[model samples]
Target: MELENIRRRKQELLVEIQRLREELSEAMSEVEGLEANEGSKTLQRNRKMAMGRKKFNMDPKKGIQFLVENELLQNTPEEIARFLYKGEGLNKTAIGD
Candidate 1:
């Protein structure tokens, strides 16, 4: 009878251990998924300067002409901002008024 009880207890312990192992596996899977999501979010959040775009193929005279045409030297802070964000439809007179 004692040997039978020991065997029953051993079976119960094995079942508990198996349940714990399954729980551990599920927890590890969840952690891996969360880590993967974090990695993607980090990549999206960071803005890295694009590679191979730092150099421009232009003459110095052309660069100065372009700046002059844009009135870069005489532009106000707001005007420069407007030019920078031209797609946003900002009014030149809207600022400092």
Candidate 2:
């Protein structure tokens, strides 16, 4: 009985480790995507700055629009916002406003 319990616990731990590895892989891929797009983002940001726009002053709505317009993100505004903000995305009224 003791050995069987240990084996079951070991199996559970292995499953958890596999899950963590998958999560880590996903995070790494996201980082790689961000790095790959960094150059374009920088150039666009610089252009906006040259036109007197402050870099960090963009609200969520405008930021979503800019990302879509610039083709920086292929997803819908809500999806992108949720991805970027981790589910703190704007409401429908907020987007309209």
Candidate 3:
């Protein structure tokens, strides 16, 4: 009786793992489909723009000092990100804004 119970529990665990794996597989497939359909060329352009944005040295310490001195730039990432997003069309949300 003990051996049978152990076997049954093992089988249940195997089934659970299989089901979870299938769910993950399906989710991945859906993501792939969405990625394929959602403006690939636009994405490529966005990637290039993002690469270029690295050159735009915001230099937090310097920027904050300048902002504090000039009273123009904001004090938070959210504010800075929104300004950049509107001005440059970059993704503020992706940067945790």
Best by TM-score: 1
Cα lDDT of model 1 by residue, 49-75, tens digit: 111011101232343334445344233
Root-mean-square deviation of each candidate, in angstroms? Answer: 12.4, 13.7, 13.1
- Regions more than 4 Å wrong, model 3: 41-97
Enumerate residue pairs that collide in model 3. none
Per-residue CA lDDT of model 2 for 1-97, tens digit only, reads: 9999999999999999999999999999999999979978898776743332221134545655565565555557575655355423334434443
In order of listing, the candidates' clash counts read 0, 0, 0
Error of 2 at 7 (Å): 0.2
lDDT of 3 by residue, 14-53 (tens): 9999999999999999999888878786776566545434
What are the lDDT scores of the predictions, listed in order?
0.50, 0.61, 0.61
Ranking by TM-score: 1, 2, 3
Sort all candidates by lDDT, best to worst: 3, 2, 1
Listed in order, each prediction's TM-score against the native is 0.49, 0.44, 0.41
